[model samples]
Target: MDWFYGPMVQMHALLAWCSVGLFLVRGLGHQFGGAWVMDERLRTLVFSSHLLIVISGISLWGALHHDPLYEPWMTAKFIALGVYFAVGHWALGRGEFRVIGYLLALLALGYVAAVSVTRQVLLGL
Candidate 1:
């Protein structure tokens, strides 16, 4: 059971990193070259990564259910992720609002990374 759980945890970590990577690349592409880059493709990739990130995150949370620190950070992270998803989807329409949505997504990603590392919510701590 321990061996199985360990590998599952590792897989979750890998997926989380991949999600962050995809989000970073997609966000940077839009920021740096929205005019030249294929906005639709990058947008699609970002949306896909968001789904992957959420799934991997949930798996990781399930694996760490016994840990005392897991619940709080996981809840906070999900709320942040939800806001990010909403912003991204909303921005798909209005051209001017897209930049704001991208910025919010970046902030949400930053929050995810920080919570993942520290395993503590700043507001809570």
Candidate 2:
């Protein structure tokens, strides 16, 4: 966990959280018709960062030689990631489902953070 590993992981973590802000912007901008938020370039940038998020996650996983499939917290976080992607898709689309997607994305963000902090898949337990 030296410079290459530690710094990259930290950078990716920062990127992930920043992406969360972009997620909020994209979702909220839908209601406000914010030009930058609705821009294709913004969407592309945000989506592209997801690739980094995945790559960093895998890199860290490999660095630790950790198997997420057998790890309950990691498993749950992955599940939440899936939900976030699905909901984010809907959130990016047009029509009534956007609201649902927006709320779910927010919840998923919180869930991911909580899981990471608590090291617990089941939050209350």
Candidate 3:
């Protein structure tokens, strides 16, 4: 792989880990009877991180297109990211939908964890 691809993948990997951390903080804040963790700055950070993660992840997937088992995780990551972003948007919006958004965020975290473990998502698809 070229230097750019390696670093790009590395950045995505790092962002994935950072997202996990952010999700955890958000979850803990909610679970422990605190405020929403993705308030303003954290929300912006999460948004940027998520966007970059997706972009970098896609680039990494393209770089590994020749490989057989390189797509499953990418597809799953995309779906997971979609949910995460949607839920986060709603959660930060206001009103009764906030709780549902929080729940979705938790599910999003679970999906992220799955992606991390599986490392291959779009198999045969």
Candidate 4:
């Protein structure tokens, strides 16, 4: 298992960025009246990418052996993940609030990145 850590980390990071990029593309395309954004194939790809991201994240968590209950940063990341998912749902939906939701989702992603890097629940504050 020790030898698996490096590759797993790389895989998880790559999948995370890929998911975000796909979301950005979909959101922008939908906003700009691109019907292709709603294509079944593309939706499936996005769904698959997100599923992989979650799977890889859990794998990494298990590999690291970090207890989330004892790690404030992990707890923060979990909360931010929930926010990202909820806002992402709204962002990809039909409504005037879509723009706001999109931006908020991005913000939540940024917070997750920050916490991941700094391991600080409070971040800059």
User: What value of lDDT does candidate 2 attain over all alpha carbons?
Assistant: 0.83
- Per-residue lDDT tens digits for candidate 4, residues 6-118, read 89888888888888898889888877778998899998998898898888889889878988899999999999999999999888888887989999999999999899888
Looking at model 4, how many pairs of residues clash?
0
All candidates: TM-score: 0.66, 0.88, 0.63, 0.93
Best by TM-score: 4
Can you list the residue pairs that collide in candidate 4? none
All predictions: root-mean-square deviation over Cα? 3.8, 1.7, 4.5, 1.3
Note the clash tally of each candidate. 0, 0, 7, 0
lDDT, residue 68, model 4: 89
Residue 24 of model 1 has an lDDT of 61
Question: In terms of lDDT, which candidate is stronger, 1 or 4?
Answer: 4
Q: What stretches of model 4 exceed 4 Å from their correct place?
A: none
The local distance difference test score of each candidate is 0.67, 0.83, 0.71, 0.89
* Candidate 1 structure quality by residue, lDDT tens digits, 68-109: 355687677767778867775544334676778877877886
Question: Model 1: C-alpha RMSD to truth?
Answer: 3.8
Which parts of model 2 are misplaced by more than 4 Å?
none
Lowest lDDT 10-mer window, candidate 2? Answer: 30-39
- How would you encode candidate 2's per-residue C-alpha lDDT over 1-125 as one tens digit per residue? 68778787787789889899888877888756666776788868987898898888888888887777777898899889889888888877777768888899889989998987786888867
